[model samples]
Target: MNERMTKQPKAIQAIIFDLDGVLTDTAWYHYRAWKALADELAVPFTEQDNEQLKGVDRLNSLRWIAQKGGLALSTAEEARLMAQKNAHYLELIQHMSPADLYPGVQPLFAAIKAKGWKIGLASASKNAAFVLDRLGIAGDFNYVADANQVQNSKPDPEVFLLAASGLGVAPAHCIGVEDAVAGIEAICAAGMRPVGIGEPARLVQASLVVPQIAALSIAQLQALA
Candidate 1:
């Protein structure tokens, strides 16, 4: 946990979640789609290249791939390519079900709801609702702020802030759960406590770092506030 010099909020009234790695393991589908597109374009995209796409929006990720491939395109070409990639991604994730949810996610949702803390989803994916609906967890959240609602991506705080606002909670009164470094930064920037669900070394700045969502508890989360 990161030491804080400032006084922290007293109670956690809401919990904001990132929908990708934090809720489900859809990153593999994202990578596969991007990789397929890259192959078609003859770009040397590796899993390592896909790491940079975490928390990035679709068009921007395509732009990064284009930059790496040394390919330039007009505005119209960019839009078409982005649409193609999204189609591929959608096809790959079409069969997702509740079973596709990450371990401990369902139990965690039950626990959070039992505690009466409002739940909000903040994701850079424009397809957040589609994925959530497929996973059968769309009704679990009290509010959702997807890529369509925000102009800026993670590390900019816009998405998380919007989620907090949607929940009718102050940013300081919420806990943001994430599985990406950019997400942690965004939560902190939004003045919310960050609970990182990944490697501690990479999430040292988070208020709490857990190996997985299953390891999280309402007691552990309340301690942070």
Candidate 2:
């Protein structure tokens, strides 16, 4: 865990979500793309190392891979590798369908809607909109903010702030869910409640942590809020 549990406020007028892990398991696709590129660059990549890339931008992820291999590339080379990795990722996601959405996602969204709260996305993936479209849930969100829409990346809170702004909700009236440490930090920095969708040890920064999205319930959310 990167942090201890923290205090938070009440009320959730909107729920902001991270795309890759929270909405679906596209993190695996990301890992495969990065791993393939790492092999071509002779960089040692592992699942453990892939954890570090979660909620990070493509160019930064490539830079980390390059640093691992002790290689310093020109700007043109970096661009080539980033493009190659994105191509692989796009190919992998071509197989995605509505069934690719994680369990309980729709249910949770329904519950949030039933409660009259808004839904928003605050992901670091530039392909967040594309992925949501592939999953056939693009119309479900009231707002979506991703890497392409933000000047800064995870741990900066820019995307979350943007999402809250787009949802027309105050930060304290929103709940941000994520599965990455950096993402949890961003949620906290955004002044929103953080609900982690992973092991508590790996996401202690969140006040409300669950083993999976399926473990979430309207009752639990109500209590948290």
Can you write out model 2's per-residue Cα lDDT over 107-165, one digit (the tens) per residue? 98999999999999998998888899999999999999999988899999999999999
Q: How many clashing pairs in candidate 1?
A: 0
Instruction: Please give each candidate's TM-score.
Output: 0.94, 0.94
Query: Candidate 2: which pairs clash?
Result: none
Clashing pairs in 1: none
Residue 65 in model 2: lDDT: 89
User: Model 1: per-residue lDDT, tens digit, 95-139?
Assistant: 999999888988989999998999999999999999999999999
Model 2 Cα shift for residue 123 (angstroms): 0.8
Q: Which ten residues in a row have the lowest lDDT in candidate 2?
A: 1-10
Compared with the true structure, the alpha-carbon lDDT of candidate 1 equals: 0.91
